[model samples]
Target: MTVWILVTAALGAALSWLSCRFLVLPLLRRRGVMDRPSERSSHEVPVVRGGGLAVLSGFLPAAVLGMLGYGLASGEYGLRSLVTFDAPGFSVLAMGIAFGFIGLVDDLDSLSASTRLLAQVGVGIIFAAGVMLLLGVGFFAGAVIAVSVVYVVNAVNFMDGLNTLITGWTLVCALWFTLLGALTGSGSIAIAAVALALAAAAFLPFNTNPAQAFLGDVGSYAIGGATVALAWMSWAFGMPVVAVLAPFVVPAYDVLRTLIVRMYLGENIFQAHKSHLYQRMHQAGLSHETVARIHAGAALVCILASVPAVLTQGWAGELVAVSIWLLVLVFYSYGPRFVKEHRAKEHGSSSNNAGGRA
Candidate 1:
């Protein structure tokens, strides 16, 4: 079963890569629908934006096969086992696609903030209501899923300003989730994580610093959806520590911190800007590659550390892992000041900006 799941996920990731290299990427390039830099952009040249369509290739098929398998094996339509079509999970996927489409429209042409907000709300309702119905999770959970999903998706989109930041983090999360699934004996979790991780790895060749391609809005929302869905399912089945931190610690921390800082300055939380801790690192003189490496390194470290935490099957390792990651979050937020400042060294900041993200 493990071998089969891994093979299936590998196929999905490989297919997604091909879609990017051949269909999705070429279509974007030919249409000249590329990401161009401005004050909001961290990159220099016009690169393809809908690169995340590649993720859909991996995610969508995995959802179908996995869900069908679960339904057959468990004798229940456990769609949550696959793509999480159940309420909260369904809503998460829906909202992610919604926000992603908004980003996609923004990529094609400017969209009003209201329009984007509406779509996000629509998706949020689905996710929130689903959790309420199925898991009986609560007002706090509803709010958390709704707000966290939007912010994380947006933050992920924000992080996409660089080369592989989104992809790199996503890759790390996926690998960690896969191992967590393996240790805990959850096939769907392992399948989903490995598939997405492989997809990230496949794209890393094109997305590394001085990246040839950008994931755009499509990719950001997609990654956000997958991250939330995986976390939800992992927790629903058991109290695994990896399931908890995978969504909240790495991605959620940055979003919450950024929102607080922006609100403190009386800025609209929804507006786009380049002031994220990672962005600040870029502004303060760290190259996109260096900043990306540091964060990706953190993610990799989390993966390594999480192994024992999951294998241990208790809260002890998880608690330690969470503390370490939380401490790193503090550093991620406030650490740049200690580094020697370098001024915005990259002129065409866009290209070099494309480092590790998601």
Candidate 2:
């Protein structure tokens, strides 16, 4: 099983890198599928979009093979296990592909917000229904899951403004999920996590500073779908809820706060804006790489803080997780201001030194 997981991850990484480099990137360039600078764009020049197709291309085959290998090796089922709907991995893969399609369509021809929302809701409900049937949960729980799926999809999309911000963050979260899945003995979860981690890592080089391409809506939506699927699978396997949610604290806070502030200011909630905390950090003179690293570091901290919850699986663990979230929330809320003030103080100190020298 361990060897299978390793092989699956290696295959996924190789496929993702090769596809992105040789297939998707060149195709987008030839087709002129580019994103030009805009008011909300973090980049100054046009870059290739829809690079996420490579991620999906890499992840889909590896994920299917991984699950199939697991089933056959465990002697649990036959080849028909490939289409088994009960397997959480199947659901995860299905969601990623489904959402990726919607995003692809939107990327090629920008869809109306209402149209996109309706489509996402439809997919979310289907995914939630699958989860409900698998878990035998009630309709209300299914609805909650459905809503969470949609929210996460948009949350990830909303944070894709900066280069490697969402991609790197997703990699960090996926790595944590891989560990969690292994510890909990959830083969589906572990396999899915490993595939996701490697795919993201493979794509990271292309998306780093001076990004050669963007994930666009396709990559962000697909990543969001897979992420929520992994989280739900972890919970379905009985991991602590707090532990499951820890990695998401930073993005959730950024999205929710941005939405609330936009509403308060009477701005269009659906309108693109450079208001996210990470975006603000970039606006405040931090480089994209620095801002991305800061958010990734914060995510790592939240994941680590939630480790206690996985160990304890009780009130103590939940408390620790909640505390870490609160601390992170505070940091996100005031972090922009803090950065501005620190920069101001440094500027003032520099001025004083210059005056004394004069």
- Model 2: CA > 4 A from native: none
How many times do residue backbones clash in model 1?
A: 21
Best candidate per lDDT, number?
2
| C-alpha TM-score for every candidate | 0.81, 0.96
lDDT of 1 by residue, 202-257 (tens): 77777876777788777887787677666666666664756456434655666667
* Per-residue lDDT over 92-116 for candidate 2, one digit per residue giving the tens place of the 0 to 100 score: 8888888999999988999999999
lDDT of 1: 0.68
TM-score for candidate 1: 0.81
In candidate 2, position 297 carries an lDDT of 90
